[model samples]
Target: MYANPAATNRFTVNAFLNNDQFACVDGYRLEDTVTEVTTPTNQPLPFVFNATDDHAAADALRTLSHSEPGDEPGQKWPAEIRSLNIGDVVQVTAPDGTVTHLAVDTVGYIEIETVGAAARPAVHPHTHA
Candidate 1:
């Protein structure tokens, strides 16, 4: 059974190192709802990112990462990392006052992998230093 899209969980993405705002993609559903996982090597404990195929939402993510193109020519991108790192955390607050945190192990995209499929170039998920 599919849950109501409107009742979907809210997520707040932020950098693990500095707690800086990364991106806020609202009403996004997870492909799998497993909150935590343990790998064989115990490296990255990635969570699924089944983001809605919304152009504005994608742009917001790109802008937060400083990957969005500037308005003027010869403009330089911000000095911050242009993608989320492996250790980045995604925090989810429940209506019951419980909080869940997921760490970035591997990043994945939904419905925006192809060229010209998105409003701007789709930012591939990456790990930063």
Candidate 2:
């Protein structure tokens, strides 16, 4: 994500079926989940919703952060996140039903979705006895 940090919510992040140097750095995919944003002060950010999408949700924040919004996302949305801020807490759910508590941490010049605060290992295929 250092090159562009695309699709990140003013964040450098991504996820896929396979792990990479950047995507899923936190070990959880940002889709198929509902993410809650809060500040160090403990205020939970409300869903940034519109007809086309909820900008604050993981799906939009993860994808739209990389691409531009469509023609009619309208005026309710703000560029407030010109990217996310440090100490902004994000609670994201993984596909296997785990919540990863991430706090925005800036490393050098790049922003990282700090991992292991309360993160769970990503689910993998396993054999059953």
Candidate 3:
């Protein structure tokens, strides 16, 4: 059994059985247990949507700080982040032409999708949980 390292709200550990059994961080094993199974070693972290202050969120607008469809080489981030990691707040351009801000939810050496691209207002999903 293994637990997601990035899973918050619990500190001890968690185990998900192959047959739909679950164990809480506090070690309460769920009924209808199943045998252990091998999980992919490369499983990614879960998405943790977050929020930010109005002034701060507005200030982290990426499009305004850099890039206009295209920017000079290395002057701007690639389609994916080249130097940022989880817990870091960054700016992103939405598909609807909105310049939004988001806090990274999954740390990795490469691009990871388990992050909120939009800085949801009024919901601090990360810190609160």
Candidate 4:
């Protein structure tokens, strides 16, 4: 849910209990006409990652740690691309403890292991820094 920053509004939350509280078919109610369950009160929120370098060749692609290209997922292959994926905003932590945020728009697959002679020549220039 989002609210407009330019608008000024007021809201209120109210509750009433008939006999201290109400109960539902599920469990006890903290308030009237409500029910409470004793499943798991503490649940961890999932992390939303916009980008990830969790590939098997992450070590070989370390040079892309700070590089950002306008890449998107499911698009036609570009002339020069390393690795890519489409996801939510990814929080990146640099070696110096600085955090960076980026939105992954695309995912790419580069077959570095099965490069033919022609493909190998084109990819050799990009494999190195």
| Each model's lDDT | 0.32, 0.32, 0.26, 0.23
Candidate 3 TM-score versus the reference: 0.21
Worst 10 residues of 1 by lDDT: 27-36
Cand. 4 TM to true fold: 0.20
Regions of candidate 2 where Cα sits further than 4 Å from its true position: 1-82, 108-129
Q: Choose 1 or 4, whichever is better by lDDT.
A: 1
As a whole number from 0 to 100, the lDDT of residue 32 in candidate 4 is 20
Q: Quick one: ranking by TM-score, best first?
A: 2, 1, 3, 4
Residue lDDT tens for model 2, 1-129:
274322222321122122222433443333223223232343443333222212234344433434456222332212333333333334444333344444343431122233565232342221122
lDDT of 4 by residue, 6-117 (tens): 2211111111111221121222122222111011331211121123332312221222322533222211212332232232122333323333333232342222222222
State the displacement of the C-alpha of residue 5, model 3, in Å, after optimal TM-score superposition: 39
Per-residue lDDT of candidate 3, residues 25-71 (tens digit)? 22221222322111233222111111233223223223322333322
Q: What is the lDDT of candidate 2?
A: 0.32
Question: Model 3, poorest ten-residue lDDT window?
Answer: 9-18
RMSD of candidate 1 to true structure, Å: 15.8
TM-score of each: 0.27, 0.28, 0.21, 0.20
